[model samples]
Target: MLKTTLGQWRMFRAVVEHGGFSQAGDAIHKSQSTIHHAVQKLEDSLGIKLLQVKGRKVGLTQAGELMLRRANYLLDEAAKLEAVATGLGAGTETQLKIAVDEVFPQNLLYRVLDTVSAQFPLLRIELMETVLSGAQELLEKARVDIALSPVPLANGFNEEFCQIEFLAVASPQHALHQQTQALSYEDLKSHRQIVVRDSASNSGKDVGWLGADQRWTVSHVRTSIDMISQGFGYAWLPVPAIEQELQSGLLKPLPLTQGVKRTAQLYLCFADGDRLGPAARTFIGEVRYQSESLLTAEQLSDSN
Candidate 1:
């Protein structure tokens, strides 16, 4: 028996990722037969089957799953080795990618970004503005180094960043507002509700009240806010994103008997929280600082 080569592992991982040999070949820019031969040679060297074909698609065998995990770790190590080598010479990353959920305060993030850019003038920044589970998905794919996600990050060091308050509101001119009586859950059920679609890759859910016979789904929270402000429907919107509307008397909180507002706790998460580059560390610190400031402001307001 011969030792398995890194090349085989690379091809195997590609096949599993792309879901088929032909797809993997297309991704790796190799002939399908060449890709198939490489994986076959790999199985022969290891004396085990790594994949099973199901119709036109391919699935990893139990052994393949374990091997794939190890391969990814090795690949990550290889990448880090290059990063370390480059850092010793360059002293900075060429680009820093960060993923953030819309649930998190955008203004605070902008402030943090401003600080990061001010300090690292030459370092390029990639901002991935995602919603719902999009941040988590980006993190899992190794697409971004840091993430501020609404959902719990499954594979990183995560800490509570801040809680955002959401107010259930509708246009002031909405029929629900015209009612002389307080709006109840039953009344809401009859009116249309604007709901933001969860951006999760799998098992994306519909959050909050859906009792309304009529529902409109939007990809982003701001879109939902726009729909609600237009008197098209009612929704639970983050208070910060609707502050102007609230102040201008365009959007008013639902006069619900209960559950007029809800708080969503967002987390600041990082895949390598401890080994973050200087740019990432600075950004995270600034983000945390701003988050604390927001919390303090909220507390003071509540006290008054």
Candidate 2:
């Protein structure tokens, strides 16, 4: 059995992420020479060349890739152990850290959290609202216990969550209301629009029949809704976020020929699958229950 140091494992993981010692050094805030020396030491100790230096670029060898995966698993287990130990001394309830997409309606999440608080008031819940990609990264890094993000994982994260529907909406006083009974994509494109800029890509998709103009690129869903409410531009918001606004006639659903519908799946990704603590498991269960209940209510209303 080869003895591996945590520092070597961290260096290996960093190199795999940044693709080079220089970049990895920048990320880890270390000198490039130091990072290279550490990696060299690791390779020497393991008796294998982990990375192949191809010109200026660095590529992982088969052994390197395998080692990286194992390294991540080992690190995750170590973190869970620390968390468990800390939790034992603190109390029976553990802290649950969750990362959520900025587009998720706070009201809905609060409803879910309220239920969890009532059930387990002693548990500490930490919520972070960030971009979808950032949230996914947090989950992979074990920076968060779980994440609430769009259905499809933008990165290589495995989807272990539920899905919700997205709706395109506008303020009731907007010009689209004139044709509310028969809204088309063309009508929406002709009006000033506020859209969630695809942070992952510069190109915008023609949602349904509505063409996105590059002039108004709102980064956050909450900002998009605020802009639409102020009549700055119309936007496609998640139904749950703007459900109350639509019901109260503050915002109106666009009448599209194809009915612009997109499903936003909420995934609860974790770094270590087997190491979920009691608080993390309880929080996940609450979210799942809330999502199922909400879906059921929506279906019942639609049926009625």
Candidate 3:
């Protein structure tokens, strides 16, 4: 049996965080005497002095500082335990909100979703297709439970999800193809460029080359692809998205001196990791597993 109770540790933490017993009492809606008793009881249970009085405010002793760290870990674990219990009691979630950047492979996304839907037939998914920083923005606002984005959430948990291959390409009829030798940035600068607009309202910025004299910004990836294929303009497009066009000779890769291909690394982020229910956890695991499988297959093909 543990000598200290969770209540005691919680009160001790509140007192330390708020800087005094009265402040902690006010924060927690408890009387100062009640907070003081809990802290005193905690010190007694631990058989050590946790706080020392200095002037009007209380300060932690050397032992208190060390124990506080351990106490915080314990408290965090306890909270996670309660969250898990709550999730279990609530059963599987009826709906899940996911924000996926358009750059991620559609086939892989479909495969993961198909598997998840099979497992939870009754669950609804709100899939928000975003671009660049859009996914991260939705996660920051707590509008999505999970986000797959190249841009990671600031000071938040993230894992390398997948890599998207971007190839700079243009139509065979485009003016850039008229060059006899390898193309340079200077050669392409005179032509028009088609770019997809960033979906985020704020904190959105352009990526890759932007030196073309005339620029056309579109809202969707398909729009950019359509414009580029019809000889409207040239742009760096994702290989997975334009595979059919590339294979059929509708779009040709640019013979650039350098940077003909670029890889964008996408990350998996959660709005509140600890609060994720069973369905969300399972989906996260499946996505990771599928991405790993794809990466391994690609690596083997590259080696051969």
Better of 2 and 3 by lDDT: 3
Candidate 1 lDDT tens digits, 73-112: 8877777777666765776666789988887777888899
Q: lDDT of each structure? A: 0.86, 0.72, 0.91
Error of 3 at 302 (Å): 1.8
Q: How many residue pairs of model 1 clash at the backbone?
A: 0
Tens digit per residue, CA lDDT, model 2, 164-263: 5777777777777776377766666678877565433323433333464434866777788788877676766777777777777777767777766777
Off by over 4 Å in 1: 15-26, 29-45, 49-66, 84-89, 201-203
Model 1: worst 10 consecutive residues (lDDT sum): 269-278
* Per-candidate clash tally: 0, 1, 0
Per-residue lDDT over 1-304 for candidate 3, one digit per residue giving the tens place of the 0 to 100 score? 9998989899999999998999999999999999999999888988999999889889999999999999988987787688668877888888888999998889999998989999999989899999999999998876888999999999578998788999999999998998899999898899999999889989559999999999999889999999999999999999989999999999999999998999999999985677787778888998999999989999999999
Collision pairs in model 3:
none
TM-score of 3: 0.72
Using TM-score, give the best candidate's number.
Answer: 1
Looking at model 1, the pairs that clash are: none
Error of 2 at 166 (Å): 3.0
